[model samples]
Target: MKRAGPWLRVVAGSASFALPTILGIVILNFLFLQLLPGDAVDVLAMRSGSATVESISALRVQTGLDQPLSGQLAAYLSRLAHFDLGVSTQYHLPVADIIAARLPDTLLLVGGALGLAVVLGLLLGSVMASLAGRWIDRMLSGLLMLIYSTPGFWIGLMMILLFSVKLGLFPSAGSATIGTRLSGLAALYDKAAHLIMPMTALSLFYTAVYARLVRATMIDVLRQDFILAARAKGLHPVTLIRRHAIRNALIPVVTVAGIHLGNLLGGAVVVETVFGWPGMGRLAFDALLSRDFPVLLGVLLLSSILVVAVNALADVLLGWLDPRILTE
Candidate 1:
């Protein structure tokens, strides 16, 4: 049989990084739970009815809340080994089920927002690069900065105020209206309308970063010797850029784009909350307020995995861009 290959090495590296993150997160979370000046037991008892100290003690035991840090961590790892993330103490539901229910909406919101940002940003960036230091470039650069500095929630709020409240253009909040009549396409339309504000807020923030990066890269490429040589050979500007500049310039952007995925995911938190979009961010917000341990752990784990995956994808892309880039 052939020896285990580079794929195994990749898996091992990913696992090595992920394990420490998991340990650190679990420890910090445990400490926070312990140090927080609140009585979860009393809260649970009050909420569940038939309030009693004994019942609260029993509930604490069930949640492993009575255990020491080491013991609780062992139990957490033991359950994690079998892919059991446990139940949410607050919700009386399986943590995985709750995450599964919410993940698609979260993915949809982030994916749509990112897709729009990258496409528009790249196009506008190319235009700005072509225009160089002209008025068009200056105007776009200023606009991009303004968009970048604006907080996503604030932008979302302004959009809602203008588009939903003043102009009556889009739905103010939620994924869809509760009682609005709808057929197949009409239902899709309503959902899209609901997505408009949050998506726009997200896209606008990311666009400036992308545009600036692309413009700088193109400018750098324009100064290269090969580009000048191609121009001297009487090549069309389009042909010179397409044949030499864009190909080389894009390699760096690929890595940058992959790294930006993490930023996009982080930004989704505020955007989701602002628009009342049903996503992991909203779930995480609620979990934090309720101190729902299981759900919180699951979200942290999932987000860490995604961030790592994007970085690994970037490494793979670097290899694609230039085969000389090597890692074991």
Candidate 2:
């Protein structure tokens, strides 16, 4: 019970900090979106073939664009207080509804990419650490460096060219095969096929980073006094690494993963756009091009929340892994 008290305090402190930060982000996002030139009315007017000045003015009035910025902001805040994300100016649908439709796709893509990167990273990093300063380690290091240096979008394009265009093994773009309906395992298989290229592209660079981080950290951990003492006790090499080196080395990796959770989510924007996936990233791209403030704001708010939640989770995990953090 005494040990749990510190954990509770840490959680409480994190929540208290996160709530105000999220509110600030919400306000800033709204203001920045408003500052962008052109409003929904102007976009509508441009799209309409024969929109007259009077028609545009009437549209502005209808959409409440004629209202002062303060009034619009007040109305927006009120709606937000009611858990309303407002209507999308471009789609004419509720912002929440639009997000609900696309959120799962983005989650799937990001989650899959992160999982793949972590798994591959830990495995390769362990191997590299075990072979430190050997030819295998040097070669693997070079390969990882190359992957780290390459841009994710370029990797995606190259993968698409090789796997989709040249060999026709996986889909080049999209979440599912168009005009084809499948259910059960078949449906899952098709989705996985579509996921391959984008997921690979998204995961590769992060995997390289994690591998390098883990390798370096593990090597450092292996040199620690505890590790040396354990070695002097005649502990098996594999058991020593498994029980001690990996555990301590993982702390930094966990921190890195948490810090980069937002980056991974943001990177989905590029990957989704490239693959024509019907996810939040692609939705955001469309919203930006169309100056759809409602959708953009919704995405920003959700993204901020996700990032905060991830960071909070990391904090809790760190506290659990090393109770010393709870004191801090």
Candidate 3:
């Protein structure tokens, strides 16, 4: 209980800090969306065959867009205080409802990709570190560099072309089949099939990054005095690597992974579009194209929260991994 007190304080501090940051993000997102050239009314006018100036003006007033910027910001902040994300001008539905409908697919995609990246990267990195300067290391280093340099969307498209178009082994785009209702394992299988291509595309670059990071950290840790001391104690090779080198090396990897969470989510925009996956990224894309400020703002707000939460989780993990961090 005594030890738990400090952790509780840390969590409380993190949440307190995050609240203001989230507010700032909301304000900034709102302002930026306002700065964009057109609004929902303009889009509506363009779409309507006989939309007059009066109709556009009336629509703006009805949508509360006629309010002053300060008033709009105030109202938005008030809505936020009450956890209301507002109604989407494009879909005419609550932003929260739209996001809730799409969030799960995103979670599944990003979560699966992250898990695969971590496992593959750790294993590959360990192998590379163990065989540093060898032919295999050089080959893998080159390959991963190539993968890391390539664009995720391009990879996604190519995968779709090869696997979906040519080989016909997997679905090219989407989270699941359109209409078929399958129960039990059949449904799971269908989802997995749809998931494979997008997950691979999303994970590829991250896998390379983690692999490189882990390899470098492991190599550095292996050269440390403590590692050398452990080696001199006649510890078995695998045990020394596992208990000393990998453990210490994992700290930086965890930090990088957490920091890159936002990037992964951002990249999902392209991957989701390329694969037609109906996730938050795709929703955000559509919202942007339609100038659905409410939906866009909601997505931005949720994304910011997710990033903050991940970073906080990373900090907690760091403190747990290295207790000295807690004191700091």
Candidate 4:
């Protein structure tokens, strides 16, 4: 209970900062969207191949697009204050509803990717650190560096080609098997099958990154005075690495993982596009192409909130890992 005090304080601090950060992101997203060359009506005009001036004018007026920029921003803020995200100009549906439908898939992808990266990275890092200067460490390091340098979308495409086309092991593109009503574990398994390729592709780069970081940090931790003392006291090499070096080394990895969680959303744009996964990243991509500002803004806003929340959780974890951080 006493140890939890600092953790609670850290969480409180994170929560306080999150609201303003999210608000700033929302405002910036709105401003950036406004700066785009055209609006949804223009996209509609292009798609229809023939929109009369009168009809275009009517559409603009009906959708409030004809309003002054300031008026539009103010109206958006007003709706936001009232907990409304407005309707999507392209889909003709509530932006919140559309985003809510897609958010879970995005969460699943990001969560799975993060979990896989952390676990695999830790294992690889430990091996490399323990076997430092060995042939296996050098070989693994080179392989990971190659993966780190590769583009995530290309990796995703190649995996799809191999696993789906050549091997017929997993579905090529989707979050689930379409046109199926399978429920229970069967449905879960189907989704997992679809998720494997994208998840691995998305996670590989981060896995390499984290592996390198952990290896470096763990090597340093193992050489510290405390580790030397422990070793002199007859501590087993495996126990020393596991109980002391890895725990200390993990602090930085956790910090970096928090930061990377936000970036995963950006990467998800490409991965989801390549995989045809129905998620917020794909929604935002489609919205961007269609000039659907409402939907895009909503997606950005929600994503920012999620990022903030994840970072806050990371802070709490950090405080638990090293309560000295809160004091500092």
Candidate 5:
């Protein structure tokens, strides 16, 4: 319990910082979106093809778009204070309901990708560090560089062509097959099969980055005085690497992963589109095209909260990994 003090303080600090940051993000997202030329009314008008002046005015008033910017902002803030995300102008459903339906898919994709990247990266990096200057290291280094340089969407497409089109091993698109109601393990397996390509595609770039970072950090850690001391104590090579070198090396990796959380979410926009996964990214894309401000703002707000929460968890993990961090 005594040792948990630092972690507790870290959590407290993160919460304090996160609240203001999220509020600021919400305001900025609202204001920035307002700068866009059209709103839901204009898009609805265009779609209807015969919208009249009076009808448009009525629609605006109904949607509260007739309110001044300040009034709209105030209303938005008030809604937020009550935890209301408002109704989607296009879908006419509560924005929260729509987001709740989609959020799980996005979380699954992002979480799976991040998990795969970290595990593969740590293994590959450890191997590279252990086999430094060998042909295997050189080969993997080149491959990592290639993967790092290539665009993720192209990788996803190629994967679809090979794994989905040619081999027919995995489904190319969609979160799950429609027109089928598979329950229990069958449903789980189906979802996993659908997820493989998107997860791999979303993860490859980050894997390459994390692998290279780990390789560098591990090599540096192996040369540190503490590592030398561990070696002098006649520790097993694997134990020394695992308990000393790799553990210390993970500090930077964790820090970078926390920072990359946002980028991972951003990348999901493209990956989700390519794979046709029904996630928040796809929803946001649709909302953008349809000028569904309520839905878009809700997505953005929720995404911001998720990023902040993940970052805070990362900080807590960091504190646990290195007690020195707590002291600092």
Candidate 6:
């Protein structure tokens, strides 16, 4: 029963977030779409086989384009309530189908990228903490600042130019080709090779962040009375740091890591655009360009849901890991 405490809280928190999260997504999508230079009507017209004001207007109403904002919103909610996100008028395909087919690709990319980022971040963070105020520590600090300041897309561009364009070492873009063979070991290596640049960019960027976080947390945890007591017991420096310091420091790191994962999912627009990786970020971008409202909304909804869900889970973990938080 005690072990179930955190999960039960997570479920409740996720449930509470549902309505607001949905409303926020609706409003966000609506506001952005409304603010665009043209609505779905004009967008559809541009891509139509035969384009004209009358043709556009007719198609608009056919796609609920004639409704008032309130009516359109009501219809949107009704359709969404029924799990019918409506077809992408532009793609002429169901939104669910597109998300289903593309979401795994996104999770694969983001998850791999995030895992690499965390490992690098933790290691560098430990090194930073170990060095503290020395020149190496200062250098690492400066490196973190540089990484934090640099944009992911810019790094991605540099990588592509150097590795793909200049050295001719790898493919310039895309996840994989239809004819690409995938057996067992060969397939694994092939995928890993493809992932190298993007993963490295993400890893380097987040390493700075994670290292900073780990450094801060480790410094704080090292100062704790328990850590002091462990040290007094003649604990080896490495064992003391790993078994006591790092383990405790991980609480805060876990929070940042969860939030970072959430951000990566939402924040991949630039990286995805650069790589043409075909994740939700790139899909959402394509939807926005073509005013594929259903696809855009679906992606938006997925991102919002993932962020809220992961954050809630992180909160629960935090609460459980540090009982003082819950007690207070």
TM-score each candidate.
0.86, 0.96, 0.96, 0.97, 0.97, 0.90
Give model 2 RMSD, 1 decimal.
1.4
In order, the Cα lDDT scores of the candidates are: 0.78, 0.89, 0.90, 0.92, 0.93, 0.79
What ordering of candidates by lDDT runs from best to worst?
5, 4, 3, 2, 6, 1
lDDT of 5 by residue, 19-104 (tens): 99999999999999999999999999999999999999999999999999999999999999999999999999999999999999
Candidate 4 Cα deviation (angstroms), residue 301 = 0.3
Q: TM-score: which candidate is best?
A: 5
Give candidate 1 misplaced runs (Cα > 4 Å).
Answer: 1-35, 39-42, 45-50, 179-187
TM-score preference between candidates 2 and 6, better one:
2
Candidate 4 per-residue lDDT, tens place, 85-131, comes to 99999999999999999999999999999999998999999999999
Model 6, range 1-328, lDDT digits (tens) per residue? Answer: 8866656766677678876876877777766676677766777676665798788778888888688877987888888879887898777889999998889778778878877877777788888887899999999899889989998888999999999999988777777645877878877776666777776776677778888988998988888898889889899878888777776666877788787876787667777778777789888888888878888888888777777776777777777677665543
Cα displacement (Å) at residue 66, model 2: 1.3
Tell me which of candidates 1 and 3 scores higher on TM-score: 3
Highest lDDT: which candidate?
5
lDDT of 2 at 209: 90
RMSD of 3: 1.4
TM-score of 1: 0.86
* Model 2 segments more than 4 A misplaced: none
The local lDDT score (0 to 100) that residue 283 gets in candidate 4 is: 93
Per-residue lDDT tens digits for candidate 3, residues 86-106, read 999988999999999999999
Cα RMSD, each candidate: 3.4, 1.4, 1.4, 1.3, 1.1, 2.3
